[model samples]
Target: MSTDGSAESRPAIDSPERIELVHVGRTLQSLQHLRVVAASLIVLYHTELQITRLTDGIHQHSLGFGAAGTDLFFAIGGFVLVYTSHNRKDTLGAFLYRRFARIAPLYWLFTFLMLGILLVAPSYLLTTKGDFWHFLLSLVFIPYPHPVLGIDRPFLFPGWVLNHFAFFYLLFGSLLFLTSGKRVFAVSAVLCALVVLKALFRDQSHLLNFYGATVALDFVLGMIVAWIFLARNETPWIIAAVFLVGVSIFATGVLQNVSEGAERALFWGLADAALLFVCVSIEKQWGWPECRLLSKLGDASYSVFVSHLFALALVASILRGLRLFPTLGVPGARIVFLGAAWALGMVVYAAIERPLMRCIDRQRRPRMARMIVAKGP
Candidate 1:
């Protein structure tokens, strides 16, 4: 439910039937909330080591398993595209318009802001002379814009996820053409192979050209979800499906090995997805309370994800001097700090992220001028 007492994950004001009490319906909404909460977990779980010029200071810290948030985000991206467009009669032009409206405005705003920062803070730019094309190509989101050099931290780290999403949009749309055929299994199998092979190669620079190949399997899995449930409305056996996959995910010790590329890719991608499927199926079998606040949290989740990094930086900077839990030791300090990080993230989303999103949405998707003859005065 949204904070305004409306249901979350339903299409919008005009699409009420979208909020059915069906098993898959419930699961989709539940997945929406789950994605929101999980993305927040990412911000809390990551610890960035502040580099100070001691004889030897840790220059970087792991983001922990927060990359799972990316997987969840990617999965949700595919889910929403299908969820929103599944039954609609959309023209190609209208389809592209809606898709562009959903993503482009805020993305462009962020990209331009990053560009400004790069211009003003030249030190942040890549030492390589070719970054101009890389930055431009990255924005266009085509097949491998490597001449531009890969992302630099603080400014561009978040943008890589955008790259994943751009391609996923293309992937999902291309599959949309096969409305009469069921090639979902074939699609997923191919993408899974691509991801595993890329992981085996294990080259980060290759990520500049081919990172999408690594994560394409997850998006393919998302399509599999659409094919099985949305296409068939196959709800009765959904639980059994979820149970089998859940056991496999757990038995493989996937979550514990978040460090391994192939392992984490398969683990979280499968886990988040199986979790989504189970929740949706359960909802179909039952009804839920109208939780508006949670719905709003889900709505603002994108903002929370993009802005959380900055919020974390702010919290880390402020907490640097306090040293309250320092005496308690690193792990203890990390625990307390994680709690504070989430609270701060919520504040940042409310104050900055949501408002900016509103502006972006309004600026894009202009209403066509209705043909109204000038009234005779």
Candidate 2:
């Protein structure tokens, strides 16, 4: 759900004088569509879980793999950062500011909205209540134990992903202050080392445990993809083979009920990374057709992800009140819920998130222009 659909100029890695930086629009566009896809899958996963719970387990089938969308998200995030910044020069402060502006505004708005709801009608939250400290932690995108659920989640459940993203931004952005190409390796090593150390110590504390989780490796896999992309590597077949192997392993593990930790990260990360490579390669060579529906969805994906819990709650409450869910059954009710969530997200994006981003960009552009003018041609 991280959409950074912007053009940037970066020199090709080979033959420095012969190479020239150009805008890589097609890959960005493909990534936009992927963002929409990833967000939708997550929505479906959550919807399935909610519906199953509401129906008293009468709804049988599982959408367990839908959670893999989150792994793809982490990879996409790392790749986007490295790919976009490969050729362009950006200071740590500037990069951090852009990331913060992109993610925090809509997040804070929705967080406060959820907070207001908690204050006004806690029952509406439906078993996902937290104290003031949890609320504060959520605002800052920090990990904390949920008062009701006893999990490392906020009242707004999906916002837990933001905690990991915030940390990734902070760690990766800080490393950008180092010399060229060093940041990727350094960041990868640090992330991997942290996970290893965490595993060794068996620490389950909030911050360390969160950082040490296998999911963090997805970002590293993404960084590796960015490295490949930047280098213009032509090993798609090898990557594709690796992807197949990874998927096979992941599937077997899931079927056999043996998936966990490092195994999960390796298999899923390989598959996700391979997916990105293939997508980028295809789009770069063949081009993605411009689709208005996908573009809008991609633009609103962040809004959808951060705000869909509210939409889900609203939809479920209404369905429950009308006693429609049982009649609709799992599949039908899931479709309705997913559609409602997507529509509500689009509305929230159009009403608040889009305008706020535009306003901030409007203010930022003049300063950027002035700086460019001052620097001279």
Residue-level lDDT tens digits of model 2 in 202-275: 75566778788888999999888878777774665765676577678558645754333556676666667777
Query: Residues 223-263, candidate 1, lDDT per residue (tens digit)?
Result: 66655556444455757778688668744643364642555
C-alpha lDDT of candidate 2 relative to the true structure? 0.74
Global Cα RMSD, each model:
6.5, 5.7
- The per-residue C-alpha lDDT of model 1 at residue 74 equals 67
Candidate 1 worst ten-residue window by lDDT: 14-23
- CA lDDT, every model vs. true structure: 0.53, 0.74
Top candidate, metric lDDT:
2
Provide TM-scores for the models: 0.71, 0.87
Report how far residue 340 has shifted in candidate 2, in Å: 1.2
**Which regions of candidate 1 fall more than 4 Å away from where they truly are?**
1-28, 48-64, 115-130, 142-155, 180-212, 231-241, 244-251, 254-256, 324-377
Error of 1 at 363 (Å): 6.4
